[model samples]
Each structure stands twice: as C-alpha cells, then as structure tokens.
Target chain A: MKHTVTLILLMLFFAVPAGVLVLISLASGWRFPDVWPAGFSFSGIALFLQQKEQILSSLASSFVFSLLTVGVTFFMCLVPAAVFARNDFRGKTVLEGLLLTPALVPPMTFAMGLHFFFIKLSLADTLPGVVLILAIFSYPYMFRALVAGFQTMGEHYRICARNLGAGPFSILWQVELPLLMPAVVAGGSVVFLVAFSEYFLVFLIGGGRVASFTGLLMPLLSSSNRSLAALLTLIFLLLPVGLFFILDLSLMRSFRKKGMA
Target chain B: MSWTNNRAGRLVSGLAPLLLPYLVLFCGGIMLTICQSFGVFTPLPHAGAALDAYAKILTDPAFFSSFGFSLGVAMVSAFCTMAAGTFLAYQVWQLPAKLATAALIYKIPLILPHISVAFVVLVFWSPSGIVASIAHSLGIIQTMQDFPNILYSGWGLGMVLAYTLKGTPFAMLLVLALLVRFDVRQIQTAAMLGASGVRIFFSIVLPRMAPAMHTSFIILFLYGFGAFDIPFVLGESRPGMLSIHVYNLYFKHDLARRPEAMAILTMMFFFAVIFIIAYSKTVQRLENGVRKL
Candidate 1:
C-alpha cells in the first residue's frame, strides 16, 4: 500500500507537469475558466516544422559546440587529473578549490571580463571562441569526476604497466583509458549537459553570430506563443536526455563486450 | 639540482599545459572583472575615481533588495527541495528492490534544463495557467484574474517554484547516492528492538543521511542563488534577481555604466567565496560534533 502511494505521488509529481506541457503544446485556444484546452491543434508542431532549417541549424551548432567542449575539456583535464591523482603536493586542496570556483560562482561575474578579452583577441562571435569559453567554464565537472575516477583507480595500474616496460603513452592509451571509461562517460555527460544547456555564456560569447538552440528558444519562451514555447521546451529537454541515453547504451555495450561490466 | 627537485620541476611542467588554460581563462577572467570593477581595464577610459562604481552600487537600495530577495528565494527553495527530496528518498529507500527500481523515475527532472523547468512552472502556476484553470472549473476561483498572481507577485514565488522543481531531483540524486551504500540491517534491528519508526529515523538514519543532506543543501542553495536561466524565465521586473540586475547593468545600460556591472559581479564573487568558507566550516564543525556522538 505504501509503495503504491509513493508510486502515485511520484507519477503525479512528474507526470502532471509533463501532461500540462503536452496539453499546452497542443492547445490552440486555451484560456482561463477551462480545465481542458478548448481546442487542440498541430499548429505549434507545424510552425516548428516550418522553421526546420533555422531550428536544425541551431540544434546542429549546439551539438557541435558541446561536443567540442567535451573533447577539449577531456584533453585538458587528463594531465592535471593524473598529476593530482598520482601525487600530492603542498596547497593541493586549496588549488583544487580555486580551480573549482568557476563552477560555484555565477558565470556572469567573469563573463563580462572574458567578453572584453575575447573581443580583443577577435575570438568573440566565433564558434571556437564559444567552444573554448564553454570548455573553460564547464571543465571543473570533468576535472572532479576524473580526479575521483583516478582516486578509485589507484596508482597500481600505472606502476604495473611501467614495471612491465610499457611506455606512459601506451599505458595511458591501452590500460588506463579502458579503466577510465566510466569516469569519462560520467564526466562527459555532465560536461555535455552544462555546455548544451548553457545560455548566458553562449549568448555573451557567441554574440548571436554563432547560433545555439538555447538562443533560439529563450526569447520564444518569454513570448506570448505558449504552444510554440512548450513545443520548443520539449525539444530542449529531448536533446540532452537523448544524448545521455545513447551514451549510456554505447558505454554499456562496450563495457559488456570488454567484460568490464 | 637534487633529484627530488628535478622530479618536482618535471611534474610542474607536466601540469603546466592544463593549468595554463585555467589560469588564463578562469583566473584571467576574474582578474579582468576586478580590474574593470575598479575602472582600470575598460573599453572607455574613466576620469572618475576608482571607487565611484562601488559607491554608487553600495548606496543603491535596489542592490540590497535584490540581494535579500535572491537570498530568500534560494534559501526557501533549497530548504523545500531538500525537505521533499529527503522524505521521498527515505520512502523510496524503504521500498522493495522491485519498487525501488521503478522509483528511478525520480530523476526525470534532473535531466531537464533549468529553462525548461522554469517554463513548466510558468505553464502550471501562472495566473491564467493550468492550476488556475483547474481552480476556476472547481469554483475555487471566480475568474482567471481572480487566481492569485503567483508569478509576478514580486515575492519571487515563481523563481522559487522553478528552483524547487529543478533542485528536488538533484537533492534526491545526492541523497540516494549515500543511501545506496547504507546498510538496512540497522533499521531492522532497531525495529525489532521495539524502536518506533520516527525514533529509528532520528537516531540511526538521520545521522547517516546528514552529510548528503548538508552537501546537497549547499550545492542547491548556491545554484539557486546564482543561476540565471530559471530567474530569467520566471523573474519579474521590479526587485529582480541579482543576475537580472547584472544583465541590465551590463547590456541594457551604456558602456559608461560597465564599472557598476563589474562591481556587482565582483561583490557576488566575494559573497560566493565567503559563503563557501562559512558553509564548509560549519559543515565541518557539525560533522565533528556528530563524530563525537
């Protein structure tokens, strides 16, 4: 009985808003004093379809930028995480904390300064600039995840590989990379989400020249087009969730194939 | 050079590639913000004193109100999110393995964007929104306008609702992570000894869950305090969130007022630093006390 109640409550908590979103997306003439939408239509979906080129472009750009951010962040975090994980040094905790401050503090605090600097370097309004900034701001999540991954992994594997006359690159490529897959996926998921969902940072750096789905969606969310906003919001939710699902499936497959699961 | 010194040098050099990007981007970005806040590095030269922007912002009542309002919204939302999340998590944790697996749905909101959560709140809670429509049909509200204006009520209820919606799943994730490692035999043993559910919870379970709760509270609080997406979607004009204020000061105003925006950002960063120190210290103290118990 208790389990049933918990299920019901959880369903209500999630499904109610979800149902409302679907209804709002379909409602053509929803108004007050009506419990149900007076009429339903595909106008919102049709409108989205009509703007397919623009929406698809924005989606593709967001995807490419986020993918690039994940790749750059993974590369950047690799040596640092190895250094931190394999060795302890003076002021390590403080340094780690300082490195993590970007995640804690509002990005707006530093974005303005970065904006001016990017413009000075002529990096503003460019795709690589957007990717670089996103990578910088979002790398901490990857850093922390990788550090935890390394800590759990311990130094034994590296030492054993070295003892076997394996080069550092070979050990890293062959042994450590496979072992670190879980951490990479975990970190990459968060980095992707952060970069993908980010709005203000992308808007500030991209300067409207580098289009993002968020840039396309945020203004419409505030507009009076409730149906369209709801439709686009669904799309926004779809992208990251869909990406994570695919990542999860592929990672699971690889782990199973490698007998690591 | 000594062998140890040479090894250390090599390590430092190895780390330089990673640290260089961070130092240049993160640290450099903050340094530039500070400089501009002091009117040092700006697009246009400033003839006024370095502290003029600070003085102007410090004297403004709007700044204080926005700060207080942000604090209130963040605190309330974080508290509520944690409360609901803790209860739900405890309940879910008590379920059988089959039911627990089904309960993975709790994480749905965690995958949604803050902006999407904001829209969900707006769609459900606005005056003419779904809840209001239901209320009208049920004769609880006479008309659409008669529905309480929760979104634009100036108390930031809209932002709070959105934050809670976004944060609850996060709190659940953190708490559940800890709970999964917890052994359930202690609760069973206590129950067998005639300990009441509430007593077992407070004496045994709550202590175990405290660390997760505290960590989630801090993370969720800081996030709610500083996040821009939800507030941008749900916030009102008057007494806006600090993020909105910074946006206006930077984008809406002319280049001359850039210092003021940077000043707000600098103060915000300072506040975040102070908050981290205080919160972590307090959590440490609490943990130590619990350990002594």
Candidate 2:
C-alpha cells in the first residue's frame, strides 16, 4: 500500500508538470472547458523555426556568457581555494563565512548597488559587466566545491609533485588540474546553471542591449501565446539537462580511462 | 620576522584574485548602497537630510504592508516546502534501492529555472488553465470561469505554490544527502522496542533531519523573501513583494527616489544579517535545551 501511494505521488510530482508543458507546446488554441488540448499542431514549432535566428542567438549568447562565468569563477577561486584548503590563519573562519555571504544574501540586495557602480565604470549593458556580476554572485559555489575537492585530494599529490621538482605553474597545470576535473565540472555545472537561468541580473545589467535566453523567454511567458512560451520553456529546461548529461558521460569515460572509476 | 612577513604577503597576493573582485564588487556595492541610502552619491543631488529616505519608507503604510506580505509568504512557503520535502524524502529513503533510484524523478523541478516553475503554476492553476479545464469536464465547475481564482486570490498563493514546487526537490536533495549516511539500525531498533512508526519518526528520524531542515528553511525563506523572478511572474502590483517594490522604485520611479530604493536595500541587508544571527542563536539554544532534556 505504501509503495503504491509513493509511486502515485512520484508520478504526480514529475509527470504532471512535464506533461502539461508538452501538451501546451503542441497545443493549438487549447481553450476553456477543454480537459485536454483541443488540437495538437506544429504551429508552435513552426513559429519557433521562423524566429530561429533571434531565439537561437539569444540562446547562444546565454550559453557563451554562462561558460565565461564558469571560467571567470574557476580562475577567481583557484588560488584562494588552494590557500583556503591548505592554510590555517587568523580570522580565516570569519573571512570564509563572509565570502560565502553572497550565496546567502539575495542577489537583488546587492545588484542595485552594483548596477549603479557598473554604470559609472562603463560596464553596464556590456557583456563583461554581466559576466562580472554573475561571477561575483556565484563564485562562492565554486569556492566551496573546490575547497572540498582540495580537501579530498589532500596534500599528498602537491607534495609529491613538489618533491619531483615540479614548478608551481607546472604542478597546477599538469598534476593537480587533471585530478581536479571532477570538482571543476561539478562546480562549473552549478555556476553555469545559476548564470544561465538568471533572469533579473541579466535583464537589469544587460539593459536589453545584451541578449539572453531568459530575456527572450520572460515576456513570452506572460503573453497570451501559451504554446510558444511552453516551447521556449522546454528548450530552457532541456539545455542544462543535456549539458549535465554530456558532462556526466564524459567525466565517467575519462575516469574509467584513468581507472579512477 | 621578515620571513613571516614575506609568507603573509604571499598568502595575501595568492588570494588577491578572488579577494580583489569580492572586495571591489560585493563589499564595494554594499558600501555604495549604504552611502546612497544616506542621500549621498545618488544619481541626483539630494537637497534633503540623510534620514529623508528612511523617513519616507518607514512612514509609508504600503512599505510596511509589502514587508509584512513578503514575510508571510516566505515563512508559509518555506514551512510547507520543508514539511513536504521531509515527508517525501523519508518515504524515498524507506523505498527499495531499485525503486528509490527511480524516485529520483522528484528532482525534475530542481533543474528548472524559477521562472519556468512560475510558468508551470500559471499554466496549471490559472482560471483558464488545465486544472480548471479538468474541473469543467468533470462537472465540478459549470464553466471554466467558474473556477476559483487561485493565482490572483490576493493571498500570494500562486507564489507560494511556485516556491514549494521549486523548493521541495532542493530540500529533498539536502535531507537525502544526510539520510544516505544515516544508520537504519536506529530506526529498526526503535521499531523493535515497541515504538510506533510515528514515534520513531519524531524521536529518531526527526532529529537526524533537523539540521538540513533548518538550513533549507533559512535558504528557501530568504530566497522567497527577496527573490524577484518568481514573484515578478506571479506577484500582484498592489502590495507587491519587497523585491518588486525595490525594483519599481529603483527603475520605474524618478531618479530622486533612488535613495529611498537604496534605503530599502540597506534595511534588507541588515535584516538578513540579523535574521541569520538570531536564527542560529535560537537554534543553538533549542538544541542545547533538548540535550538537557
């Protein structure tokens, strides 16, 4: 009995939302008093194809910025993460907690002030500005992940590399980085998702000059065109899921090659 | 002493890449906000006193109402999401390994952006939405319009539902992380000792899950409180969320009201800090008291 109830709920929780989205995406004029969509058509798909350039460019822009954020955050967190993982120093705990504050406080709180500053610095409505704000907002996730990654990896590898007379850059690039792939991927995935799905930050700082998928999707969501909105939303959902799937697959394959799996 | 100074300098320089941006952006942004809140460095010249913005915001009934509404929505949604997540996670944990793996389907909502979740709620619960259509077909409602206005009932139920949907999976993920390491022997031993299922859950399982519950509650509550995405989609104009109010004043209003907007942001920043301190202290006290018991 318990199993049956859980199964039913599991279905309800996952299936209903996805099922509704699929139906709406294919639906043509699904109207009042209709239990199911009235007519399933390719009109939404047709419209999507027609506006493919605009939609796809926005998507590509979002993808590019999100990846750039991942890179920026990775660089930003690397040395600090190493320092944090290896060293015990004065005020370390307090400083670490303060660093993690961005994750806790809503981005909206600081975004306005950042927006004001960005404008003065001529970074507003620029791609770099969007990426910078996103990196600042999200680098904490990478910082935390890399700290854990370094802890799990321990001092042995770095010590071994040093004893082998490896320079710092060489050790970081060749020895440590290869082992740190999983952590980077894990942290990068999160940073990517946070950056990709972000609506307000991109919209405000981008000021509509910078194109983003969320920027394109937000207005369509509230509009009367349900099918197109549904279609775009599915794309929004699938992109990250696809990226994670590929990431997991490649990580597994590489780990298996190294006999680490 | 020179060697020690050199080591310290190296440490500081090593951390400079991360610290530089953080200090320059996060701390800098906050400092700028405080300054602007005091009617300094705003877009326009402030001829008024430093406290003018605070006075206007504090005296306004709408600001208070918005604050209250945001608080109520956040608290209620966080509680509901936590309850549902804990219960469901417990259930999943109890399932057979094969089935438990399948139950990972619950995480579908986690990858979804907040706005997408809002879209899902809007698509399902609106008057002309799928739920209403189903009700009409089933004779529960005579017409689609006869369906209740669940989305815009003036209670922020739409935002609550959206938050719960998006947050439940997150809560489950956190709890399940802890639960995966939990020993089943404790529950088995309790069960054998003639404890009812409810008693075992409350006594044994509840304590195990408490840390995650508190963490997720704070997280989801704060996100719901200050987050603009979900609210922007589901929120009403009158008595809007605090984030929405700030957004409007910052963007939609005149340049002079920027100080007022900054004032609200500064207040929220302090509130968040106090909330974390107060919450952790209270949790610490409660835990210590429980240990004594």
Best by lDDT: 2
lDDT of 2 by residue, A150-247 (tens): 98999999899999999999999988898888899989988998999999999989999999998899999988778888899888878888889998
For each model in turn, which proportion of the native inter-chain contacts is also found? 0.63, 0.65
Model 1 residue B12 lDDT score: 79
* Candidate 1, B1-293: lDDT as tens digits: 56447767867776776789888988899899999999988989987999999999999999999999989999999899998888888888888988887887777777777888888888789888888988887889887778888999999999989888888888887778778877888889999999998999899988788777887788788888887888888988888899999999899999999999999999988888887775555456554745564
Tens digit per residue, CA lDDT, model 1, A1-261: 988999888887876777778888998968876788889999988988999999999989999999999999999998889888888788776677777777878888777888999999999999999998998889988998998898899989989999999998999999898899889989998899889888988999999999998888888887777888888777776777787889889989998998988
Compare the candidates by TM-score and give the number of the best one. 2
Name the weakest run of 10 consecutive residues (lDDT summed) in model 1 chain A: A92-101
Alpha carbon deviation, residue B260, candidate 1 (Å)? 0.8
lDDT of model 2, residue A75? 97
> Which clashing pairs does model 2 show?
none
Off by over 4 Å in 1: B1-5, B279-293
Winning model by DockQ = 2
Question: What tier of docking accuracy does candidate 2 attain?
Answer: medium
lDDT, residue A29, model 1: 69
